[model samples]
Target: MTALIEAESVKRYYSNASWLQRLLFLGGSEIQAVDGVTLRIEKGEIVGLVGESGCGKTTLGWLLAGLEQPTEGAVRFKGRSLGNIDAETRKKVQLLFQYPRESLNPRHNVRTILSYPIRKMGHTATADITARIHSLLEAVGLSARYADRYSFQLSGGELQRVALARTLALEPEFIVCDEPTSAVDMNVKVQILKLLSDISREKGISLLFISHDLSAVRFIADRICVMYLGKIVEQAPAQQLFDHPCHPYTMALLDAIADIDPNAIRKASLHGQPPSPMAPPAGCRFHPRCAYTEQVGTICWERGPALQPLSTDHLVRCFLYPEVSQDPDRKQ
Candidate 1:
């Protein structure tokens, strides 16, 4: 079967210099926010995109959700290109931003906020809109009483639920949930994760859960993709990834979530910061911080390795896997 959403060799870049500078042939650096990423999300599958901040997770999410266009490649929904998709088709793909407070209009009450999407996305009568708003609130675990309350009246978790309800109001089939749980407390975070998981299961909504939190991603994602400096370094089944991480960056991210123990022999310890996207490192972007660089030798520095399959399902982009087949941009 065809994937529900596919980003094939997608690339999104930004120029740091003005248009006039480019017109004058003046030199300006290009920031490659997402560089040659090929990803696929099957129907009803929650694919977790895990990486540190500035790794281009949110930028990729924006591209997949059709909020921003890619400089090259294509984002296809089902079997059709997103660019060619009609406005009605576009409504099937929605984005839930990192911050609910910013997404929700401060002046708008809950009823008004939920009703706007229903009215705009399709023609609905005032009475039907009210009924739909109440239904949506209940779907996200919110009560009918919240209809009159503004964003300020809700807690962080409550606000996130409202934001989710708004997204659901569009009746989306695929949602790019960009760091939806980042702002909430631990208890509230668990609740939100459960809510997303439940919603996906019940509604069969394919989700790209982009987050820096490994534990949260592990809880909700069916498959996990580890990103580094605008590229996906590794991807695998969630249980397989957490149990046997192949890439050094993936190891480091998983290690970060573990309890600190001085005596523990960590699989990989990340040092220094990620390189700037404006000018990423020559070879593997994670090479500078990777622990196996010395053992793997100059290959890790001289060339970037293809994302080769370690097992049938797990793929890793590191020279340490010498026996894996050569398929640079192959999709699973």
Candidate 2:
């Protein structure tokens, strides 16, 4: 099966410019927001990206959605490069940002928000456009009465639902959900997840769900990928990953969610906070904090590890797991 969206060695860097740059020629350092992230989302599949706050999961999501161009490599949709796709074709992939309250226009009513996307269908009667918006509201579990309501009039969950309604209005083939449930309460979070899962299955729309909540991702994603310091550290079938995490970082994430399953792993604290991407560690980005890294030698401290297959459908990047290392003489 062909991938609905493919990102190859994608990297995104943001340069910092100080006030002195306006006067002098010196430029500030570049922040490595995303570094060498390659991923594929198969048609009709939901892939979850879970990671620390600054690990570039959201940046990768936006890169795959074509909202931002990579500093290197390319993002392709259905074998066609993102740059070659026209506006109409580009609409096939959409991005739902982390916060709906900020993502949605505060001034626009629900009718105006949804109707904006239908305008791409070319000029249509105002009544027909409104009718379409009403259907979208209903589809997102909102009543037609919502059409007259402004974003401020709704709660966080309600606003997110309205945002989802606007997204569905475009009839997109793929959606990148960046922590869509983060702002809502626990009860509402489950409802939102189910709604998204149901909508994906019903519409056959593939989804890239990015979140820090492993349990939620495992519940909603067909496959799960773990990111660390701007790189994907591990990936596998959701159940497989939750059952047997390969990378130390993946294990730490699982351990962090100890409340979910008492027997999963003891509530262990990680060594320290992740290093800044602007000046990442010399070797494996997680080496400074990974307990297993000490089991290995300089190999884990001198060079970064590439993602290697652990099983037929599982991949992990780490030096402790020497069986998957490409370097034949790599330190044990």
Candidate 3:
């Protein structure tokens, strides 16, 4: 398939201070929400972006979806710079935020909420808009009757269904789904994940699914990218990464998840909060929290390791991986 979106060395930094602080002439550091990250999504694919909270997954999503501008670097859609694309062209990419309740407007019913985006884009007339709304509701497994209910009246799952419907109402070619299942119940989460998977296959829509839920990603993604401190630490096919994780951070994340059997050995190998991104460690951002990192590692501390390609597709950024660390030319 063709490339739908590409983020070339993307970096999005936000001021640490509030607007009031800046107005008062306060001095504050910057939060590197997305720092020097490069990624690509192909047409008709689901790429899972997994990381801890504040690891730049959502920020990168917004950049890809054209919702947030990158402080540095560029995002390209179908080989066209995102900055150059007009609103109408950019709407081909959509962002599905984490919280459905917060995403919806309380005053509007589902019908009005779904109709507005289609109307704003001027895609359909009054007669076709209502039919489109009904189909969207049904596509998400929600009945057409729920269209008249306000957001507050619906359950979390129902509300999320409405949110998905709203995003689909636009019939976007690509979607950046930020923790779409994070706020839903366990059963509902599975249902939603399955629904998304089905939709991607049925509609040939590309998606960048961002979440900390590794298990969910393992189930739903074609490829997985692990992020840490605003950088992509590893990129591999889901099962391969799980089967032979090269990076220490990736290994730790695998261990963090509870397997099917409750009797399986469970342990938390990584400790200490990630160091502040505003003042990240000079070398590998994950070095401080890596249990495998030892005192003899000067390269891991003095200089940042490059992203090494273990195979044609699998990539890791760690000094321990001699392929990347020993040879500087290898790039993923």
Candidate 3 matches the true fold with a TM-score of 0.91
Model 3, CA-based lDDT: 0.87
Off by over 4 Å in 2: 17-27, 260-268, 323-332
Q: How many residue pairs clash in each candidate?
A: 0, 0, 0
Runs in model 3 deviating more than 4 A are 17-27, 120-124, 259-268, 324-332
lDDT (tens digit, per residue) of candidate 1 on 103-198 = 899999999899888897664888888889999999999999999999999999999999999999998999999999999999999999999999
- Backbone clash pairs for candidate 1 read none
lDDT for every model? 0.90, 0.87, 0.87
* Winner by lDDT between candidate 3 and candidate 1: 1
**Candidate 3, clashing residue pairs?**
none
How do the residues 1-332 of candidate 3 rate in per-residue lDDT, one tens digit apiece? 43789998888988878788899999589888888888888988899999999888988898998889988888999899999897777788888889999999999999889988878767578788888888889999998899899999999889888998898877888999999999988999999999999999999999899999998999999999999999999999888998998888888899977678977765436798988889888888888888767843767778787887899889888888674344433332
Q: How many clashing pairs does model 1 include?
A: 0
Q: Pick the candidate with the highest TM-score.
A: 1
- Better model by lDDT, 1 or 2? 1
* Model 1 alpha-carbon drift over 4 Å, by segment: 121-123, 260-262, 323-332
Candidate 2 versus truth, CA RMSD in Å, comes to: 3.1
- What TM-score does structure 1 among the candidates reach? 0.96
